[model samples]
Target: MEDIHALIQKLDWDTSEAEQAEAIHKLQDIQDEELRLLLQPLGKEYWDGAAEVIVKLGYPSVKPILPGLLEWIQDMNWPGAGRIAPLLREIGDPLIPYIQDVFRNHSQDEEWMYWIFEMIIDYWDKDQIVQIQEELIRLTEGKIIALKALRTLWVHQIYSGESVLLLLEDKMQRSLTEIAQLEIAYPGIDCEALGRGFSEAIFTPELSRAYIEEHREEFNFCHRKSTLHDFVSEIEELVSECMGSGNAPA
Candidate 1:
């Protein structure tokens, strides 16, 4: 193990590709904490090798290393952080709290953070939805990330109407003009089509109401069977139920 650690320490990224590969292969066999401690300083350049070694060491062995790995991710400049998605996926639910912290605290790093959220969404417990929604709302704010998060929540139907109503109200007031302009700027496509696309993309049902309200004349004559008020009523009902449940709306 000491010899293996020495070899890992001596490995140069500038070295020939063959030498790096050979070092990684040998490093995989060293399961001692002393060896891991020695190799920990290699940073992201060694992530591929480290991940391989950690995974091969099995979950029990790798469990001890997660906290350190998670701490490394908090460093914006950490090279090994980029490999976190795969590592967390490899580690599975045991890493959920760590990933959630990243999502909550790293609002500016939405691109990377979203992948972490995406990974954990599948395993989210129902009770966790309120917190997840709050995090999503806080992180996304006015950005496209909010839209994506909403879509994810919508697909899962995780939020009650009350939570959704808050989001709907926010979107109605904030994004109405932006969406209307999108319709006006692109005259060939009707508002319903745009609403459908928005609904599909953001998973917000209120977008449909906003679309109809903005273009009432265009859609009213074409679809006489259903009124915009009906949709609004449905949304309100959902919102009431969500609020009554006392869950924080996402």
Candidate 2:
């Protein structure tokens, strides 16, 4: 086996372009499994440069790296930990079967399921997205992960992100006398995401109320029990104002 110590060292972010080129060349000479090793980075917290090199190498760099990623993702916090999502996007549709399995297996792990869905989003057509959504919805029925899947449905334009966020609005609510707590009913739930749904203005009140009313008893809602009249009035005002604004973009 060729020694990779120097080559890995040269791939550091601080290295010159020519040095990086040489390191990349040496990386290309390494076997696929070893190439996957190079992704560890020349130094700690150096994912940017390492990810760039991996992503730039295109399909070859990503293929062998994926199985490990499929496992690593289980422990990862997406949109925060690393650039792996972009790298996975470079891997693309060819890894569809693998990702589907990841989502299927980790349906209860909300963040992992979210990122895996994101990595594979662009690859699936609307029809495929719908199929996947229905399957996940069934597997995750009445759980927090079902709300997470709603985010993906919004991304595919099959549902509005706001509408999905609205579905979680009740979870974010609390009466003045009461404190909000994570819904104990659903394990591994992501309450902050539900909070983000409103803080970010990604909510459609009418849509949220319809869902809340439909599943009033079954939803793992963590909010204080507010009066039905109050909820109705809130949705009505939102709908009236929105209609006046020509159904303002959700």
Candidate 3:
């Protein structure tokens, strides 16, 4: 055990890459019992170096310690926490059940859920990630985690955009654009109300040229008409692309 600890200590970020590789190779060579025993220290503390070796060792090697690793990273701000994703990604489909467990049990932890989306979920395939799409959509109903879940869906292209908008738009009156504008808007009658009204008018149901033209007087931009026209055209084009690829409701 002392020898395992010494080897793990040698895996530190401060160590030379060559030396870290050497330590990893040595750890890999250890007998199965010793290797399994070494993993027991994981998530018990911030042993940053140990993560890389586990990623290299892969799969069943870390199965016993998987739950602890998940819990340990709930802090999200831990140094070298980024390395944990590669290990989890390497574990691949085997990590799905545990991820579902986290979503099921820890859905209330917005930051933890956000961390899972930002750092971990993107590395997975759409099929693997879709298992949690329902949960992700459910989280969007909450004020705090909505943006994070929406982003995970949008950025990953996890669902057809129309499907996502349909699933969420009625349940959530504010479009992502409207929500973002309101969230960042200064708290005042002029600034807040204009942002709210403008975003809702432009984004609700569909963002189209006809809609923008019909509500043109409501657009209070200081820019020239051409600029506003161009902006509206761009948004219209983007929505068209999303709807084109989406799986529409039957």
Q: Lowest summed-lDDT stretch of 10 residues in model 1?
A: 222-231
lDDT of 3 by residue, 59-126 (tens): 78767767666664676567556677667666767777787888778887867766776667866677
Q: Model 3: which ten-residue window has the lowest total lDDT?
A: 220-229
lDDT of 1 by residue, 143-181 (tens): 445655654465456644445567867754554455455
What lDDT is obtained when candidate 1 is compared to the true structure?
0.56
lDDT of 3: 0.61
**What lDDT tens digits, residue by residue, belong to model 2 across residues 1-250?**
3477666776666789898777666566566657666455545434445555565566755677776666544545422135556666555556667767767665667667665655556455666666566565554344345544554565566655455446445433422222223234344544445545444443777766665565444444433323333444454444444445443323
> What's the true lDDT of residue 215 in model 1?
67
On TM-score, who's better, 1 or 2? 2
TM-score of 1: 0.49
TM-scores of the candidates in the order shown: 0.49, 0.52, 0.54
**Residue 206 lDDT in model 1?**
79
Backbone clash pairs in model 3 (N, Cα, C under 3 Å; residues 3+ apart or in different chains), count: 0
Could you give the C-alpha RMSD of every candidate to the true structure, in order shown? 12.7, 12.8, 12.7
Candidate 2 collision pairs: none
- The per-model lDDT (C-alpha) reads 0.56, 0.54, 0.61
